[model samples]
Target: MKNLQKILKYALNYKKYALLNIISNILSVIFELVAMLLFIPFLNLLFNEKTVIVSSLPQFSFSKDYFEAYFNFTMNQYIADNDKLAALYFVCVLVGAMFLLKNLFRYLALFFIAVMRTGIVKDLRKDIYNKILILPLSYYSEEKKGDILSRITTDVQEIEFSILNSLEMLFREPISVILSLAVMIAINPHLTLFSLILLPITGLVIGRLGKSLKRSSSRVQQQMGVLLSTVEETLTGLRIIKAFNAEESSNKHFDQQNSSYASLTLKMTRKRDLASPISEFLGAMAMVGLAYYGGSLVLDGNSDFNGGEFIGYIIIFAKLIAPVKAFSSAYAIVQKGAASADRVDAILSAKNPILEKENPEILNTINENIHYNNVSFSYNKSDIVLNNIDLKIEKGKTIALVGESGGGKSTLADLLPRFYDVSSGAIEIDGINIKNLSLHGLRSLIGVVTQESILFNDSVFNNISFGTNNASREEVIEAAKIANAHEFIIQLENGYDTNIGDRGGKLSGGQRQRLSIARAVLKNPPILILDEATSALDTESEKLVQDALTKLMKNRTSIVIAHRLSTIQNADEIIVLQKGEIAERGTHSQLLSQEGIYKRLSDLQTFSN
Candidate 1:
């Protein structure tokens, strides 16, 4: 119920529809009760032989004048005119009309319930997607993609059907039960009180059983997330699985996760199923008790208790059972929905670790210099990835970062784009700290190409124009030519329109890398960061890409992270890093003369060549 309160806050905005549904449910219950009670008068009219008027009853008696007045009016208007034939026809017609009206209002109530149900579902999914888009990249590094996807789809669907729909039933069914009970008590208080005594016992059983269901449901949802994440990872790396011939190993891993999920689901289902039969059994026992007591009172010839009223009491009691069943079932659904709400809340309540300061300045363009002054950083309080790094690049100069792996080469490149902030220092473009600049403005001024080419499942033209929405076809083709991608792109089945499958899988590795470079070229930023852009290509592809890279780097303030020693030989200056510190800094020829780490790296590459 607490979880229901939280979800209702979002649903509260559509109160008009909820109110209308409530009114319709009330009307439906009223009409249904009227239909059930109509049988009392009609039965008395048919069984006139033993029909006991109020004045004729021995112990239970009314004043003769009042009883005669009511009796004469009923006989003259209804029973005496048509006898049993007329009474039976009248009861059938009246009951049928009441039922028709009840069903009509019931349909209208459910229609509005559907509106509120789907509206809330739509709003929740939209909010979750928007939050995901605004969340920091660092957030993704610590969470699984499949878990997030499951929250948006499976978890949200659970809330819609189980929670919202259960609320609709909860509101309508309880009202129906109450209305039916009122009619039952009016006819015979003794039977109504006897049946209601079983209610507290049923409540105690339900309370105890449902106490653990919410906790178990939460565990089930979490296990499902794990299974979904495992399947996602397996699909993403299926090629590797086949290449390594690890099919049996992958199947065993999947089976383990699948079996765990199955066990949790079975447990949750057992807990949910417990509510139904327990409620029904209690209701049936109450009915049996009523039948024995009411039959004995009628057989004793007590004029106070007549056969027709007894029959009406039984019909009303039967109506009460359905709503009681619904109440118990809806309670179970509420528990399941509560579990899902907690998962969604976890994602929505998470605070972004990286955010812009208030009233941040916007930097439109860079003119003077890009400076890294005593910059240091660490991720998650671990060993420093960068330490007191100091460097400067004039507006139009090429500075190459040459270092071994894990030497913070790519980390430095990432900072220039503000993908991360320095832990203890500042990075500035044109003397203004980048942290002070608008995030959008800071990213718009730089372009990046990494070792792994990041492209989507789209046409070649869209891939190149991804960063520049208004780029013309001619501009796109020119950027492709500069990236040495035009020749292969035009030869495809659909030329620029050809679909590059997921992650550009339909293209070769070199082709994908060139397309990434083309995307950067189309963006045409003042500062470009090439992080080992040619390291993954073969000799011939590297030569072609290096030529394209030379064309792209011309007149741009470029930061190149080079792995191949020969690639940075003509760089303006090369900095060699060792364990988050600069070990050597010089031109290629001067570094060779120093006979240090850079020299050894160059010699090794030379021998390999």
Candidate 2:
């Protein structure tokens, strides 16, 4: 119940509908109780029992005169005629009518409750998805994609089905039990008192069982996350697993996780499953005892105990069992839902370490220099990836970064687009700190092409025009041509409309890179960051990509990170980084002549003189 309270805002949005459901449920319970109570009159006719007649209805300020009049009138008419069969038939018909009306309103109440429940679930899912999209890149580094995916799909669904559904039952079933009990007490107070004794014992047992279910459910949900993440990883890297011939190894890992998940699930299910049978057994015991005690009193001819009234009391008592069973089952579901809610709340309440400042400045375009002033960064607390890095690039010049792996080449490239912020110092554009700029405005100023060419399972044109919405056919083709991808795109059976299968697996590595370059070209931002964009290409593909990159780099402030020395030899300035700091900086010829880190790297690449 407390777990549900966390998301009350979403639920409260449709409070009017929820109120209607409650009203309908109350009406349903009233009608249902009326249907059960109708049995007393019918039993009296069948058994020829003494009429427990009251001359006037018990006086209460709120009691309506019409209700008392109707009751007296019916009783008098039955007594005067003494037609037992006709009275039984009339009571049976009235009972049937009340039952029918009860079922109708019950259906309507459940339908409206479902609407409110599913609507909140839908809104919650949409909010989570939007948060995923807007969250900083750093958030993903420590989180698993499959875990997040499970939260959105699996955990949320559990909350809807188990949590909210339980909440509905919690409301409706208790009202039913209370209404039925009221009628039972009205018929026979002594019998009602006998039945009430078991409630405390039942509550204690249920409480003891529920105490462990929430913790067990939480463990089960976590194991499920691990299992799902493992499966996701296996599927995404299936080709690698096959290529390495490690299917047996992968299966062992998957089986271990699967077994753990199964064990936890079995434990949770056992706890959840225990509630119904245990509750039923307790209810049965209470009913058997009540029947014994009441039967003894009736056999002794106690003035308050009558055969027909006792039968009606038993009938209403039987009705109480169903609601009790429902509540016990709902309690288990609520525990499971609480466990799920905790997991979801952990995510929803996570503090994003990186957030845009208030009253952020907006940059429509980058028309001046981009500066990295003593920028230092670290992914973890242990070691710095970049340190004391000072560099500047004019608006329309090309700057290239060259370094060995772990020398912060890619990290430096990432900082230009603010994919990550500098740890120690600031990055600024046009003398304004990048942190002060709105995230959308800062990112809109730059385009990136990374080593891995990420594309969705979509058409070529759609992939290229992804960033720039509503791009025309002519504009797409022009960008493709500039990327050296137009020729191959046309050669495909569907040309620009060709579907690039998952991650562009249908295309060759070079072709995928070309498409990625085309996507960046389509956006045509003022600044470009190409991180080893052509490193994985063959000589022939490299020539084409290098030509495409030359065209794209023109009149744009481009920052290129390269492993292959020949690719960036013609840059305006080249910087060699070593151990998180600038080791050397100069033009290509000057660095080559100095025979330092840059010259050593160039020589190691076996570049032509």
Candidate 3:
């Protein structure tokens, strides 16, 4: 219910629509009630040809008797002035007009609600996407991508179907039931009280069924996430699966999850489907009891309940059954929706580890050297990835990090932009702690090109100008030329406007890397971090990418993480890392002459080449 309330909070954002819906629904219910009340006078006309007419106008009051008296007086006057048929015609026209107004207001209510319903869903999706963007990278290391995808797509759809779709029933039905029940109490208090007794009993039964439904629905939603995760994994690893000829095994695994999900959905839907019929049966029984009691009163002559009024009361009470049953079904549906709300709330309420200071100072440019003061980091408590380390990198210096795989080179470079905060010490730029600076201001000064060139399915121009705002066509082309991507880009059919397929699959590895470099060049940050930018390319692509990287790194404070030793031979300084600690630090020539760890690594790579 807490999660359900959180979802309803989004409705507060569009109060005009909600208010309009409420007003329209209230009017619709009023007209419907008046339409039903007109049937009483029609019943009198049918049963009594010489019906007794009230001679004078009745005093106005709020009780049912006064309105009934006034209505009778008006009908009597009309019948006397004309004939009974003319009076009946007037009543029929009035009833039709009331029903017409009822439906009009109902349509208006639906019109207003449609805007609110779709608006709430749009805002919810926007918030989830924004939250995904701001969450620290470490959050994804433990969570599955498909499960998060399920929350944004499938879980939100469940909320729309089960909760938002019920908005009409939730708002309209209750008002109908309340207004009808009030009239019932006015028609006969004793009978209305008897009807009320049956409701709580029906509610108790429905409540029990609903409790298990939420639990079952939650399991179904979770299984959906697992099934989606399996599908996502299979799509991502299709090439590997085909290479290894593991299609049979993969299919069997997917089949098992699919079967489990189907079973859970079947059971949950069965429970949810039970609510409507049970409410209907219970309401029918309550109706039978009310008729028997009310009929006894008219027959025994011990009460003033007449045949015509009794029949009208029965008609209104019967109308009440439909909405009551609808209410019970809506309750069951809301229970199911609550399960999905719980899943969405988990993400919406997730705590972000990265915190910015309220009045953080701006970091527009680097004036002096960057410093890593006694830095230590660990993904967890026991497995430290980096030990206490201190280093300073002067502005405009190309400092290269060389090491074997899993030696914390990438982790060290990642810490500079605060992808993950240090576990112990702090990193500072221009003598100011990075934590003391605004994230946007701090990151705006740095550009990163990683081993995997992250490119989207977009035009060559848009991809290059992704993070850069208001970049013109000439600026984008100039940036591509600097990264050596302009030659191939112009050869394509649409030049800069050509669409690069998913992850830039339409382009070669070298082409993708060059585009990544072009994007960095366009941003033209004062600081650059190149993480193995050419490690995955062939010799020809490597030479092209390395040349562009050299141009992009010119006069910028660059931290280069590399595995190919030859590429960093001309670095101003090279830091060799081993076992999460700095093993050696010197110029490439100086380290090779030391006959130490750097000397052995350089010789090993030299031999391999």
Most TM-score-accurate candidate: 3
Question: How well is each residue in 1-609 modelled by candidate 2, as lDDT tens digits?
Answer: 555578657888788778889889999999987777666655765777766555554545533334434555676577668776677777789889998999899998988898898889988888888778767788888888878887888889888878788878877988888878777766677778888997666767877787688889889888878878898899899999999999999999999988998899899899989988888888888889889988887778846667777887887787888888778878777877788887787677777766799999999887789999999999887978998999999899898999889899988988866777789888999999998999888889899998989899999999999989899999999999999999999999899999989999899988998899898999999999999999888899989998999999999999999989899989999989999899998899999999999988888779554
lDDT of each: 0.84, 0.84, 0.91
- Candidate 1 off by > 4 Å: 1-5, 46-76, 181-196, 290-307
Which residue pairs overlap in candidate 2's backbone? Answer: none
Q: Across residues 1-609, which tens digit of lDDT does each residue of candidate 3 receive? A: 999999999988888988888899889988988888877877866876336579999998999989888888998899889997898889889989999999999999999989989999999999999999999999999888889999999999999999999977888888888899989888889888888987777788888888899999899989898988899999889999999999999999999999999999999999998998899999899889989988998889778777777898989989988888888888899899989999999999999988999999997899999999999999999999999978899999999998878889999999988889999998999899999999999899999999999999899999999999999999999999999999999998899999999889899999999999999999999999999999999999999999999999999999999888888888999998888999999998899899998999988988998
Using lDDT as the measure, the top candidate is 3
lDDT of 1 by residue, 1-609 (tens): 555576667788778889889999999998888787666665655555355344332333544335334644554456556876776787689889999999999999999888888888888888899999878777888899888988888888888867888979887987888878776766777778988886667667776767678888888888888888988998899999999999999999989988988898899889889889988898788778888888888778865667777887888887787788778778777888788988887788789766788999988778989999999988767879989999988888888998789999988888877777788888999899988888888899998998999999999999999979899999999999999999999999999999999999999889999999999999998988998999999988998889888989988999999999788888888989888878898788999999999999988988988
The Cα error of candidate 1 at residue 161, in Å, is 3.3
Better-scoring candidate (TM-score), 1 or 2:
2
Best of the two (2, 3) by lDDT: 3
Residue 468's lDDT within candidate 1 is: 93
Worst 10 residues of 1 by lDDT: 52-61
| Count of clashes, each model | 0, 0, 0
